[model samples]
Target: MDAQLGLRERKKARTRRAISEAAIALFLERGYDAVPVAEIAEAAEVSKRTLFAYFPTKDDLVLHRFADHEDEAARVVRARFAGETPLEALHRHQRAALERRDPITGLCDVPAVVAFHRLVAETPTLRSALLHYHARSVDALTSALLETTDGVAHQELTARLGASQVLTVLQELANTNQRRINEGRSADELASLALAEADHAFDLLRNGLAPYA
Candidate 1:
């Protein structure tokens, strides 16, 4: 039974990948709104019903790539060491992602990732969907920080503010990396710069930022 279930899962994953890849190719070639779901399904050699079963909305075809990172910040907070503050944990998490060249960290210069980002930037629908993902990440991070035993005064307000600030810092870091990549900077040429940016941003979070002009 377990083997059968494993096989089924693998088959489902394969189909989903095929559908998403086809959808992206079509979208990249002919703009997001210009490409119909029917064409995506046809390109994937799957029935429309099958495609919908895997991805409920058309946006899912492109945006699903981000689903894995949705709760990542929250998960990092929850998994922090006992002595670690939420801010510290978040900083460490961002550093690790940058070091590993994670795509969500937006440090990747791979052609496919570049194309995917270009599609999102050029497509209003996908850009809006990206905002939705970021909002959800903020909410999840807030919840995670609240779950920790930190003695933060006004926990709800603190959680929301902290989460918002951390996410904003991350978004800026990603934009800087992506901008450099688009300007023909290789990932190797930018790693140390990315690390320095992370250090600068996280230091502000670590040490209070109240005195800034």
Candidate 2:
């Protein structure tokens, strides 16, 4: 029974990947708005129903890769080691990801990845969808923050505010890197810039902005 379930899950994952790859290829070949679900389904050799089963909307086909990272901040907070604060855990996770130059973190300046960033930025609907995803991530992180703090007054409000700052910094870092890549900067150069940016951003979070208050 377990073997059958594993096989089924693998098959579903493969079908989803095929559908997403087909949609991206079609979108790149023509344009995002110009491509239809039917065309993508045909390209993937799947029925429209099957394609919709994997991805309810066409935009999802291109952006589904982002789903994994959506709750990453929350996950880090929840899984922090003993004696680690939520902010500390999040900063360490982000710094490690930057050191590794993770693509999902937008530290990668590869041409194809940069093109995809440009494509999403150029499309209004995709940009809105991306924003919505980020908003959801902020909400999740807020919940995690509330869970971590003990009996703190206005914990939910504080979490929401902190999550907003964290998300804003991350978004700015990603956009900056994307812009540099668009301007034909080298990945090594972008990595250096990102490391510096990450340091300053996390430092602000760590040292509290009380002086400005």
Candidate 3:
């Protein structure tokens, strides 16, 4: 039963990838707004119903890769080690992603990733979808923090504030990295600097921001 379930999941993942690749190629060949769902379904060799089964809306076809990470921050916080604080766990996670050159961490030189970033930045629709993903990340992180928190008055509010800061800092890092990539900077060239800058940002978050004002 487990093997069957796993096989089903692998098939679904392959189909999802096929649909996403088709959509991206068409979007890049033309413009995002110019591509139709029917064209994408045809390109992926799937019926419109099948494509919609994997991705509900038109935006989902292009942005579903981000859905995989929508709750990643919260998972990191929930799974922190005995002595690890949420920020510390998150910091380690970010650094590891950079070391692996994960495109989501802005530490990848993959042409597809660079092009995807450009599409998201330049296209109003995708930019809006990106915000939706970030909002989900913040919500998940806030919930995870609340679960482990105790005796703090207004714990919910505090969790939200912390979640906001952490996500915003990461977003800023990705933005900087993408801008650098646009300038022909390689991912390896940005890793050390990103790590240093990220460390400083996390320090400010950990130590509190009262010193900034």
RMSD per candidate (Å) reads 1.3, 1.5, 1.4
Arrange candidates by lDDT, highest first: which order?
1, 3, 2
Residue 78 C-alpha lDDT in model 2 = 94
Candidate 3 structure quality by residue, lDDT tens digits, 48-102: 9999998999989878888889899999998999999889999999989888887
Of models 1 and 3, which has the larger TM-score?
1
Model 2: clashing residue pairs? Answer: none
Alpha-carbon lDDT, every model: 0.90, 0.86, 0.90
Q: Give the per-residue lDDT of model 1 (tens digit) for 108-176.
A: 999999889888878888888889899999999999978874786998888888889998899889988
What TM-score do all the candidates reach, one by one? 0.95, 0.94, 0.94
lDDT of 2 by residue, 35-140 (tens): 9899999999999999998899988998887889899999999999999998789888888887887766677877677777778889988988998789899999
Q: Sort the predicted structures by TM-score, highest score first.
A: 1, 3, 2
Positional deviation of 212 in candidate 3, in angstroms?
A: 2.5
lDDT of 3: 0.90
The candidate maximizing TM-score is 1
